[model samples]
Every structure is written in structure tokens, then in C-alpha cells.
Target: MAVSHLPRTSGRLAIIAGAGALPHHVAEAARRQGEDPFIIALSREADADWSGFDHATLAIGDFAAISKAFAAEGIDRVVLSGAVRRRPDWRDIRPTLKTLAKVPSVLRTLVSGGDDAVLRMAMDLIEASGARVIGAHEVVPGLLADIGPIGEHTSTDDDLRDIEAGIAAANALGTLDVGQGAVAIGGRVVALEGAEGTDAMLARVAELKADGRVSSRRRGVLVKLCKPQQDERADLPSIGPSTVAGAEAAGLAGIAVEAGRALVLERPAVIETANRSGLFVLGIERNARERPR
Candidate 1:
């Protein structure tokens, strides 16, 4: 497995954790690289157990506390990882002087925009606190999806049609900043991910299949790609073992994600699960524009 390298920066790194294992993976990778990361685990949003690490639990909108922690810890580089379940309520925010002026804009985006806009607002606030924001893949390069199959199975010719359809649908869905994933069966799009996310979308596919709304004889493919104007530093499309299980339950024949532009959490486990379930897990080229004939 070839891994990309990110330029190493001096000073302490902070993991602004949300919900999922990605933050923990980054922290472990940092430790292997001989750095002790200060974890800022978001309360309620972060479900991981942080007992072994030096960490602070704070609310998502507690900018005042986050800024103070950044200053005290001398954090120079920060990685925002995992999922935030909901937008912060106005009453929950405790903004510092530096972020006070931007609170209204943040709230506006949170109310009226997509996840990408909200993340940009959060990143702006993080930078205002004097810390540079970096992608989780920068901290753990091996997490990036490589070009080609990472599992035992490869996509069949029939699967290629679904993959192409999925890629097109995903890009169209992304253009609206709605979501990054889509499911296609028999060269027809069956679902487009929304705020409910990939898992929920897959669950819906399963329901549709059970209700005989979608073709059960011809299994589909789930494709996750980076949004058309996505910030690669945060929220690159991600997949894991759970993704494999979801695809399996949804009767998918394979899964595809944008190579180098997507994150594959627990690659070995993801591949193993996909292989066990006889599903192809492929990493297509990032700028895959040519449709399969």
C-alpha cells in the first residue's frame, strides 16, 4: 500500500473530535509519528471513549473555551475529524471576542446552507483562534483511498454501468451541496444521499428493495465521491466496515469512492468485510469523467 506524505509541522496538534473512529485513528497515527495530540472532544457529538488521552470535552459551540484551550496548549495545527450530528443552537454558543462578530454569519449558514458552508464557517472560526486547520488524511496518509480495487473482488461489467450512473448522480447531488453519495442499480439511480447521511440512505435502499420498489435481482452499487466544490481539508467522503455492512444489507454488489479524494477508514477491515460478503470495493480515479461504454 503506497501512502502519501504531508509536510510535518512543528508544535502541538489538536484533534477537534466529533462522532466516530476517525479522530481516534488520527490521534494514534500522531502518536506513532511521536507527537502527543491534545484532543478537544465535542460533548454529545463525540461518542468515542477518550479516557487514555489527554483531552477536554467541550460543547460544539463553546468557542470561548476552545480558543482558551488552543492558546493554553500552544496548538499550531488542528485536524477536524468525524461527524457533527446537528447544528449548534444560538443559545448554546459561547463566543470569544475574536469570533463574536462572525457568530451571526455562522448562525445564518447553519440555518440556510448546506454542511459544506457550515464547515467553512467552523474552519474560519478555528483559524481566527490562531491555529491552522489540516485534513485528517494529512495526519494519517494511509487513510486515503488508493486507485483500483482494495478488496479481493473487482467490479463486473454490469457493475461498471451502475458505478458510472452512481458517479454521475453523486456529482449532480454534490453540485447542489446536498450530499456526496448515490446508489445506482441497473444503470439507473435509486437514491441520493441527503442530510440523513450515507447510512440512512443505504437503510432506505434496503427498505425500498424489501418493498419491491427497486430491482432485487440485479444488485446495485453505492458510490461516494467528493462534492464538486468540497473542501478536501474537512469532510472528504468516507467509508468503513459499517459501510460494507450497509451495502450488503442493501443488496449492493459493490462500492466505489473517489481515489485520493476520499477516506477509507480501517481499510483492512473494510476490505475484509467486503470480501467476505462478496462485494467489490474499488477506488476510481478522482477526475473520472469518461463514462464506461
Candidate 2:
């Protein structure tokens, strides 16, 4: 749903903030819509300054505290935002009665399953506590990427080939619930993002190029796409100014993400960075058949 047309509710909105600027962005958007959102900043995981809003800092594993805060603040709607750097220690979790029964299964998933599975379980727990979970995009739809080039530069035919290779690799990786990003160069898959994430994957590519393992003559493309079984409300693939800098340092020709499914953080800054670095940022439509769960 579009941000402007979001249905109004009497109940307050609570932002379960983690690391990065995304949570701040969502909070600002909510305020613009005339809602005073209560920020539930996860201790250590959240990095933004939340002093401007009505907020409480709490441990990520303290579910009992979070549930109590939600009730006290009258927060019936919740939006999960930002990157979580670490999984909570099983010993630290203090589940409420509603979540106590499923604690064992949730802990098992946290230890063994991939990110998608862990997130799904987290969302289920949040709902079980009586608060409705919503995606960050629902609060800030303008952040979604549009189709075609987002900067002055555009992809070349050779770059398109690399992009195609990246898409295939990224999608396959997503099917395993491993990650959502891949790098392709000279029309061949070069690196698939693992738990280390997109930036680290690009850094690896740069290192390989420096060692002359991968050819530096031909640049590549970085493609990020949603997992076939991804829940759109959280952890959508995203790129920003730092991504442009990483691609430039990695000697990449461009970056591509699924048009409607990816988030383009700090669009203006990303565009300016890409243009100055002579890199292209394109949003391509994903092929349904190519995404096998």
C-alpha cells in the first residue's frame, strides 16, 4: 500500500529499531503522517539517536520487557527496521506467557535456520504478543526503487551480461536462504554473498582483483534481489551510498536490484555517488520463473 493512503488507526505505532539509518527514516515518515511513533530501540543493535522520539532502549532478548513496554505505550502496530548485528543469546531470552511455549522451537531456528526462517519466527512471536507486525516500506513507500537507471550512468551491453549472471547466482543463493546478493564479472558468476553480507562480498571481489585472480580489465555488476520465499515486510534487499563506494572500489561497472522488491536507501546520495564514481545503478524486473524456492 502507498504511504499516503495508509489507513489511520487509533492505536500507536511502535518501531522495533535495530542498526543503521532505516529506523530513523521510518520514524520520520511516521511523524510526517501525523503519528507519534514510540521507538523500541534494541540495545547495542540500534545505533541511531532516538532521543528526539518517545523511546526506550532494551535488550533484544528481553521479550518480557518489550511486551510490557508495548502495552504501556498502547502500541498495537509494530514495524521492524534496520540490521541486527547479532542473534540474542538463548539464556538471555525472557519470554512472556504467550511466547514461552514456542521458545524452544524459536531458539532451535535461531541456532540452525537461515535468516528468512529466523525472521519469520520473530514476526510470529511479535504477533502472538497482540501487536500487528508491518513492513518498513508500509511506513515509507517512497524509498522503494523504481525501474531503470537511478543515476547519470547506464549499464553497457557487457554490463547487462554480468547483471544477468549476477541475478541467476543471487536467486539461487536466496533459494538456499543464504543471502540476497551476488557479483558477476565478464558474464560469469564470481562471488555469492554469504553471512558476511553484500559489502564484505564486494570487498572480497576487490581483494581478488588486487591479487590478479579476477581480471581487472573487465568490470562487473552487483545484483541484489529478494528471496523467493521472502517476507516483504522485513529484510528487503537494500543499497545506499556506501554500496556505490564499495562497487567503485571493487571496480564494478554498475549495480542492479529487483525494481519493486528492493529498497534504495538515501536515493539522492546514492545517485550522486554513483554518478561521481562513474557507476550505474539500475533497477531491473525479476523473472518469476528464475526464482525457485
Candidate 3:
């Protein structure tokens, strides 16, 4: 079968900027591909410069409003990227009648957290509005990390054991919608993240170690994974140089993430910092199950 490539300059592109550095990266890549991206900034969740796109709009959780804005700009190609802060409480939604009507159905499909279903629904909505939702990575292929340890040094025996143990524990916690991250030392869990967030979880583990609740052979390990059935387009767990700083502060020997499933923002700097601190930063697949002792 002969494949036909769509001309890169063929259509209008819209960037639904959320938060963090990903959206900006996507926008830059879109410009490189010869499309002037129309940026829509999520209220308080996206960068201020996002408003400088060819056309821009600000909205909270109102999907209908977002759809209307896209329609107004005549955008037929769209890409969504960046960090969206999950809101369990719906008080601030201010939903339009159209969005309100879909809320019950979305909630029924979504269950608790994880935005995969919601993004799928949003993609459906975008398609219905006569636009195609493109994969965010297609615009920025280099952002994907190479599969491996991703640093200068290999993990020590103790570091490897802790990494495996942390991955297993994190996977278990993810099954419950608790979180995708955990801290461990000597093959034992010291802290499990929840709604409080990763930094807070690290602090809690540090406190527990100070109080002699969890002991470390030398230090601990931080492991983050993608929840089973997680939406890769959104809500994927991410780490970077700051994570290494957090691990150092909490006396962690290493950090492990699910290979190809986790996002490593600021890759060069993150790896450099990890190497400088003698921290092991490795990636493993989801089924790289920790062996039984």
C-alpha cells in the first residue's frame, strides 16, 4: 500500500496549552513544522505567553467554551500537551449547559482520577467540531527519552534492589488511585504518595527516617510509574532535575521510572544533576517485576 503524507502546511493547528513546560515545547515544534499554532491557555494553568498565539482564549474547565473558541478560529488540527492540575472538587467548574449535560457521563466513565477517558471524550468532541486531534509527540519527536539508565553511572547492587522494590510498591499503590510514586529503602516502603503530591511525600519520608520509622542501608529510592490504563496523552507521571534535588534532600540513593511510560522534562540538565549527585536514574518497563527475595 502506498502511503500519502499530509502536507505540513495544509491546515490550521491549535495548541491547547495546559501547564508546565510541555505545552511550550509543543508550540515551538508546531511553529517549526510551518504551522502557526493558535494557543488556548487554560486559566491559571498555562503560561502567559501562550496568549500571544495567532488566536488565544482563556478558560477553566469549560470544555464547551474551549470547543467554541476553536471553532471561532477555524482550526482543523489540534494538539494537547502540558500538565493539567487534577481537580476532584467540582465547585470551580462553572460548566455551561452543554458541559453540564456531559459531566455525568464523563464522571461515570472516568470513575475517580486519571484523565485518559476524559481526554478521549474531549478528542471526540474536537472531532465532532470538525478538527483532527494529533498526537503531541509527533510534533516533538526528540522529547522522548532513549530507553536505558539515562545517566553516567550504573546502579549499585543496593540501588538496583531498592529500585525494583520501589517499582513494585508504586504499581500496587497505583491500582488504588492512590498515586504512581513511592519511596523505599532496603526493600521496604517508607512513603506512598497520595493527593498530597510527590514533594510532600518525600518530606514525609524524610521525617519518618528522622524518627527511626524506616531505616536505609545508605539512603532511599524514588520510583514513579504510569498507572495501569493511564492516559498517555494526559496525566502521565513526570520527573526532572528537581526530582534529583528532592531525592538528595530526602537522602535517596536513586530514582527509577517506567521506561517509555514516564516523562523526563529538561532531560540534559536532569541527567547532569543526577550524575553530579551520584544518583541512579534508570528506566524499566511496566512488567519489569521485582523478583521475590
Candidate 3 residue-wise lDDT, 1-293, digit = tens: 11123457556788888777778767886677677888887776786475446656566556667778777777887887776675424444434565546455555544553455656656655666668876565555545544567788556777777777787888898776568999878877778887776777888877777787777446878989888866565556878787888887788887888776677777888889999988878777767655212
In order, what is each prediction's RMSD in angstroms? 2.3, 3.0, 4.3
Q: How many residue pairs clash in each candidate?
A: 0, 0, 0
Sort every candidate by lDDT, greatest first: 1, 2, 3
- TM for candidate 1 is 0.94
Q: Can you give the lDDT of residue 151 in candidate 1? A: 90
lDDT of 2 by residue, 1-293 (tens): 23444688889999999988889988998898888999999998999999899999999888889989988999888999989878776787777878867555887876787888778877887887888998777777578887788989988878878888888888898999988999999998889898787889999999999999999998999999999899988999999899999999999998998887899998899999999999999988776323211
- Stretches of candidate 3 exceeding 4 Å from the true structure: 1-9, 47-57, 86-104, 107-124, 289-293
The CA lDDT of each predicted structure is 0.88, 0.87, 0.71
Badly placed stretches (over 4 Å) of model 1 are 1-4, 101-104, 286-293
Ranking by TM-score: 1, 2, 3
TM-score of each prediction:
0.94, 0.93, 0.81
lDDT of 1 by residue, 1-293 (tens): 24456566677899999998888888998888777899999999998888889999999989899999999999999999999987787678777876867555876776677889978888989988889998888788588988889898988888988998998889888989988999999999999998888999999999999999997998999999999799888999999999999999999998999988899998889989999999999999645654321
